[model samples]
Target: MSSRISGPGLGSRSARRAAAVTPLLLAVLLSGCSSGGSGGTKASSAPSPRTESTATATAPASPDAAAYRRWGIDKPLAAPPAPPSAKLTDGLKPGAAPKVIRRVPTSDKVVFLTFDDGAEKDPEFVKMTKDLKLPFTMFLTDDIARAGTGYGYFEQLRGEGNRNSINNHTLSHPNLRTLSADAQRREICGQQDVLEKRYGGKPPLFRPPYGNYNDATLAAAGGCGVKALLLWEATMQINDMRYAQGDQLRPGDIVLAHFRGPSELKGTTMTKMVANMLRSIERQGFTVARLEDYV
Candidate 1:
């Protein structure tokens, strides 16, 4: 037989203990449910391992990565292959008018960067090149190089390495196609003398002003000790590139740009223009190689 305990005071000690413990047990269950809900929320909000791994994989990795970022490049440029022991002259003869070269003949994924006219003298460009160890060739006109502090500025750009070569552009940047042979000789040979004296050696390369050249221009360039008449497959502007052939960059293509500043670039700095050029180059899966290396 069972008896019913109706009042709190009428219950046994064990029954009273259970009666008091039941409220605490309910409180603990509620608390655990609340905590579990919060834990689920946190787990959903946290980043997954796959997301983290993807971020790590896409980040630029190189000693100069920070420098590249500073200069507006997304990644550090690929280092060029070591220069060949025997320079590739592409069947260029020693005595005749130097062979005209629009591109180096090589299978390596490389292009040459050549800058013409020392018009803009930005000190920061020197810092950028040095910071990145970029290699390029300069074809400086005498009038522009001698103007103001341009000569010293280019000297800073030449630095202490043989990677940056100073070549002849001409005395006054006249269109060689319009000039007589004697006149062309004065333009090419005269600037040759200036560059040799100022830069410490005779330049072995020459680029005709405005990409304009004739047989007389080549003959005069050879007379002035030019070994090759360098031309361009692409010209880099402030924000875009103009290609002589297709819209794409080709292996060993020579790219032309100028030492121009905001005045000529629609208010873009020379460094920014160069950074854009590099971005274009990177998009094409190519890196800059020293033009002096293969030519």
Candidate 2:
């Protein structure tokens, strides 16, 4: 949850973007959220289905990336493997220039899962992601930690495999636009230092709280070395998911969720919420892929 902590083991998860902006854009714009559930959200749009060579994963022919083969995927991705990333661009490098991105531009039927706020630290959610071998990303806020350091669960996530990327949400979940420029820097750059110290690398990505940002926000983010200001195309709740453009899933969407537990979700656990999300993804014939690999 990125909003206020309502109670122990409970926090408010917000996909509550700028109420002034449209949730779904007729075209792929720099829009930020879909709808928030107890889970995640993504951003982007397409008039029709797009093709992605990177959408499929067969038995990994290489030893380095072999973990892709063990995915406990529900059905065949039913697509061919993408060619090697010869000359593939790496959009995740620090200081790459900050641009608002609703979704990755690709033809591959791969989507990203990004959970914001470090609120509900659920051990079972960690196990579920490991068991499924699903690759996703995390946009974390420091103040929302559940226990000592509030980072143990994420450390646990990192230890399990090489499938996820950690990003900066902020020190506290505040609308950067509401604060002064230096305060904004403290919010953006301050967390950059904290996350780097804790996670061992500076976060190259960032997502403003409530999908709220302005020109000053982006400027502060870029000054603090953020490469991309991420938004979403879909949002996930406890029981189901929401879309930006239409009811159908489009290629290259980045789904958003929160690290929440039973307290915030009408007594539903994070595992159940994730299960519903996976069902939605499978129903759409899309596969979960490493967000960093294709960016």
Candidate 3:
């Protein structure tokens, strides 16, 4: 979404279009891409399940165009696979189960990209997802999203036809391990109420800050209508991701990012961060999936 980047203006449409070529040729390397990790089951080496680019999607107009080569994506954007037919949630109730989840259990070449907090609300990030037609899962904290009415910014993303889900982090980005179970429930459920009032539904997922959680965190999440306590296999940085296992992205991994702006990125931008994420996925042969769909 990464094979080449030969010029400037990586943020410009023209620059992205300039680095055009079919990247499916690298699909064969997916089998040898990465070793399995604790983050869900390893995804299959095959990349055909999520194929969306038709034969008519000729050169220059590819949906997976190198428009984000500066961000590091070297492959065309392929749609993610549909919800798996069987998984951990097969017999569980819709609104509840499972504590301290790290990732889904499937061999499909699918990973979940989740953004946390709600710091920077960049319009360009919205434009980037819209322009690229990519999808992601958001675990939003109340204080951050409410800053300067930044909730409007997230609304813009939804208004523009992006179908990403919004989940709860907490009222404040607190470390739940230190809080009592009642306090944790308030943090988790308070944000759930706020999100449902704003985004139209209670979030099915909940993530503890810094991946910190305990037995109390799980019990609190269940009481607040949260079905899963999500964790991650990778945390995205300004330019690259810190993987829990090997350097490569394993299938079924859940990667984390933030709604940050330039100041937090050491003067870089979130758009660039996301672009590089797509590039990494391209290089590894994995497509992004909807987190709620899997759970």
Candidate 4:
């Protein structure tokens, strides 16, 4: 319009138009900014992409990953299969001498770890068992286990739920094969009493010292309420395992290890030795199973 408009009405209309356009302009600006404007100065509360990726990459995949690393294991140990419902005793009979077994009779790719004598009670080993939820059997000798704080040490290993078992080794670590019938009975039965009184309930399993046994030893064990005489298919030493027949582990093999420390293991801790043993088992694709669950 060529004509000039000068009045309060014209001023009011211009103000209204400006007021309406102001909101539209502001809304357009906000929409552009929210659409990832290059000049936007807004800071985000969310983590950056690189930070998120790094976090995911560094996170452990398993709850036991740290534990496996701490124990020098490359990977977490495979879990054993569910225990048999009826619990196979490997043809154990009642009212007779308990059957001696070097290995459990099963087709599963599992092996049993058993510790003997209870000579060295390393606190770390107890922690390891709890950390790994490891299952093993202990054959304790009265004289050795009861010695100077040894019983208390083993009591720590015997945690709740009875995940592990304590069986009779002997009153004294003696060659039952060399002892007389009465003497064998005394040794076997004496420890039975001690274990029953100390741990509660008679043990269903027994292992003669040095794996040396005779008819007299079996008879004594049976008389003392022992249901099975456990021997081993392999003996785990500080650095390696000694198999009875072959160089490899067989399914259901009972692996014998000791409650030993640096003194007995040539400066290797019991936990470290166990870690190495577990590595060997892992390498062979075998898993650890509870001996009590089977026998």
lDDT scores of the candidates, listed in order: 0.65, 0.60, 0.60, 0.65
In model 3, what lDDT does residue 219 have?
68
Comparing 2 with 3 on TM-score, the higher-scoring candidate is 3
TM match of model 4 to true structure: 0.76
lDDT of 4 by residue, 1-295 (tens): 0011111100000001111234432222211101100111111122222211101112111228678787787787787877554433333445466655667767899999888777676788888877777778888888778765757787777544566778888887776666899999999999988878876677887877766666787778888888667767676766677666669999888887777666444568988989999999989989898777665
Model 1 pairs in collision: none
Using lDDT as the yardstick, the better of models 2 and 4 is 4
The residue pairs found clashing in candidate 4 are none
RMSD of each: 33.0, 10.8, 13.0, 35.6
TM-score head-to-head 1 vs 2, winner: 1
Residue runs of model 1 more than 4 Å from their true location after superposition: 1-63, 90-95
What is the C-alpha lDDT profile of model 1 across 1-295, one tens digit per residue?
A: 0011111110000001111233442322211111000000000012222111101112211337888888988998898776554443333344456656666666788888988777678999999987777778888888877776857888777644345778888888776777898999999999988877765667877877766666777678777777667766677766767665668888888887777666545678989989998999989899988777665
Tell how far residue 270 is off in model 4, in angstroms.
Answer: 0.7
In candidate 3, which residue ranges exceed 4 Å CA deviation? 1-75, 94-97, 159-162
Report the Cα lDDT for candidate 4: 0.65
